[model samples]
Target: MELQQLFLEAIQNGTMEGFFKLISYFQTQSEPAYCGLASLSMVLNALSIDPGRKWKGPWRWFDESMLDCCEPLEKVKAKGISFGKVVCLAQCAGAKVEAFRSNLSTIDDFRKHVMACTASDDCHLISSYHRGLFKQTGSGHFSPIGGYHAEKDMALILDVARFKYPPHWVPLPLLWEAMNTIDEATGLHRGFVLVSKLHRAPALLYTLSCKHESWVSISKHLMDDLPVLLSSENVKDIKDVLSTLLSNLPPNFAEFIKWVAEVRRQEENGQKLSEEEKGRLAIKVRYLKKFSKLKGKKKA
Candidate 1:
């Protein structure tokens, strides 16, 4: 069934699935000129794309380090990433993506396509942004839609450039006009599409490894923080804290990295860790028992 029919039928039959699909999304952080990449990241997470893959042997992993982010966006020099570049990079990352840009596509056709695409959980959609739908001054931009609200004729746009715009409930008709506008940069239409991972298992495991790395990352930061705490505190309980922390250090940094990567796969959703992330993770784990503290001593 097409999304338009699905939503209509769901509403007629009194079901809510047609209107909502909860997914994760994050704002573009630090990379001022990477909204395309940021939008890609949001869609990847929304669809749970793992971005990692296995080699021919199924035992060896493909080296993800060779994936140059900027190389794919070759058209983007100092300007924002073009829709074409976004498609290229996403294809490299193993995403199933398509671009919708045709002068022949009428407003009604786009309305149905957008409604069908955003109405399903299997679909992850993103498109260009403007001040009218988003209330932002800039017109040519990229963002994702969480789902659609048929009753209200609104589409939930999960804007990736969160620093500049919060997510909004945009009317589908208005958003369609925004998507159809010609981009002078590429002379292409601005619209979103459904994105999903080509490979499932490895990507999921890769995601899990990230969460594990976060857990391990906290312990690694303790390496830098512990020394400071020990030196600055006159509190007598400090010795016990130091002893406990030191004892918790990984026996060997390399071994810990190997062990963490090896075992992390068994973790819920975390089935694998990238060799690059493993190396960096190990570097952070090195000297987990070391650090300094300074304090101003005020006489009582």
Candidate 2:
């Protein structure tokens, strides 16, 4: 199938069947290079989230910029090595250990490969717990990282688990523990528990680490139970403040009511953080640059 036809069908069908159909076609092509295979794979994985017909707003996030910034093969030549040779070896049918091991020369390349596959719909849970605080930058596009993929991924997981898993596997205590970890990690654990009982995983993890407090720590937790939260609701009050603001939020404030409600509920429940919260909670945030980078500025 043609790429344009696949995109059009994906928009109308709301099923990623066409996307994967094209991916399989690409994967089976003779002498397919890693660039083509990897690029198609990323697009297939992303479009499978079904962003909805009306929500085609920022679908381009799945394009080349994402690949250039996050794909390991793109960084192969950056280390004074030959990208051509690497791509050639990757295309070969041989499973030679030396060839694959050579590709791990740079830490960035190694991590980017891991980032490409982790947090996918196949092996992990997609985050669905919404904080309900949407920021309107008054810009034409949404925040650099904002999208509907999170909700779509979660819905897909729930649909599968509801029919696939047994009753025992869907117990609340297991989900509650996962939810607790996500909450401490993201302050959205309560939302996870309230939203889904099957699994608790953050939708956007390492991809948005550029906006995180510590990219290293955030990267470490990419596959962990911790949740990544983003809301589209309008922010109304000070309670809606994010632990990290990617940028200055717009004047619209109604989007944060959901987060405010969660905070109020947690307070009412006496859910005060213990020792873990004291030590780890502070590190979870992506500290504001003006405060952290400015000399002699206090860390409040």
Candidate 3:
């Protein structure tokens, strides 16, 4: 198979060997403005679906030397390459944040890093991760761009965040770590925007917490503000949370319906609830004793 085909297939099957071959292929090119960007994105897509794959095989080939050959943003720009592709490539190689930071020693390097992190459609935590990885010189504290330019860029970050993507719908533990990190960095605590970014891990967390109100209460304390930012339209994507909540709530469909009505009312009024809130409400409805009797009444 051609290298491109091999790369595409490797991404589909999550094979480390194919990725290794692709990386080898990537190294041969001296003017890798476009190819490097594409190759990086492919690597990201492959590893994101299976982060564990990085533990061995082709992933190991991506040592410091390989990272060094990547072209700087300006060099890529001067060569007329699309900066977006560069962002995508770094993102794919899982080197986005790190790549930008590694080069942030100069004022120009810092500008590129800021632009990459705040790029629309880029994940904020990824930006945060990169910033955290490469701390500023002679500064014990980290700030998300404290100057005028940084402030301007933050507006762009918030705007990009509002552009919603389909739910990730996968289960991942690392997402939890990301959430905790965001909490510490922003001091915002409990909002759906962060959970939504977790892709599919929110479902898992909701499931575990639903059965234990104590657990639910504790986690909610940490992340309750999520629903406030989510739209009713997006609530449909996280219906699984509602299903779990309904399953565990006290048995009373009427009361459950009432709760749904309340949430629906909030949703209608432009309120957003996190998966936890939706799940909590769903379980309460499912457990309603009225539902059990309704089953018997149908038979009678």
Whole-model Cα lDDT of every candidate shown, in order = 0.55, 0.26, 0.31
Worst 10 residues of 3 by lDDT: 139-148
Q: Measure candidate 1: CA RMSD.
A: 17.1
User: What is the alpha-carbon lDDT of model 2 when measured against the actual structure?
Assistant: 0.26
Query: Against the true structure, what is every candidate's RMSD?
Result: 17.1, 22.6, 20.4
Q: How good is model 1 by TM-score? A: 0.52
Per-residue alpha-carbon lDDT of candidate 2 for residues 105-191, written as tens digits (9 for 90 to 100): 333432232222232222111222112221211111000000112222211112111122211111222222222222232222221
Write the number of the candidate with greater lDDT, choosing between 1 and 2.
1
Off by over 4 Å in 3: 1-116, 125-139, 145-196, 199-213, 216-284, 287-300
Candidate 1: misplaced stretches above 4 Å?
1-23, 53-77, 102-104, 132-135, 199-300
Candidate 1: tens digits of C-alpha lDDT, residues 1-300? 455664465456333332344343455533555666676766665565554433344432222222344353333435777777777767766678766764555667655655676656555666664555546666677776655656666666666667876666667778877776777877766665557656544321223222223445555656675567666655368577766555444433333343343334333344656797566545544422222111111111
Cα lDDT for residue 49, model 1?
A: 58
- Give per-residue CA lDDT, model 3, range 1-300, as digits (tens): 443453344334332222232223222223323233333333333233222113345352332123322345555534523323334334333343343322223334434443333332222222222112123121011112111123222111111111121112111122222222332323332111100012333332112212122433434533663344343323455575565444334333333343333343344453466787677656654564466565457546
TM-score of 3: 0.20
TM-score of 2: 0.21
TM-score of each: 0.52, 0.21, 0.20
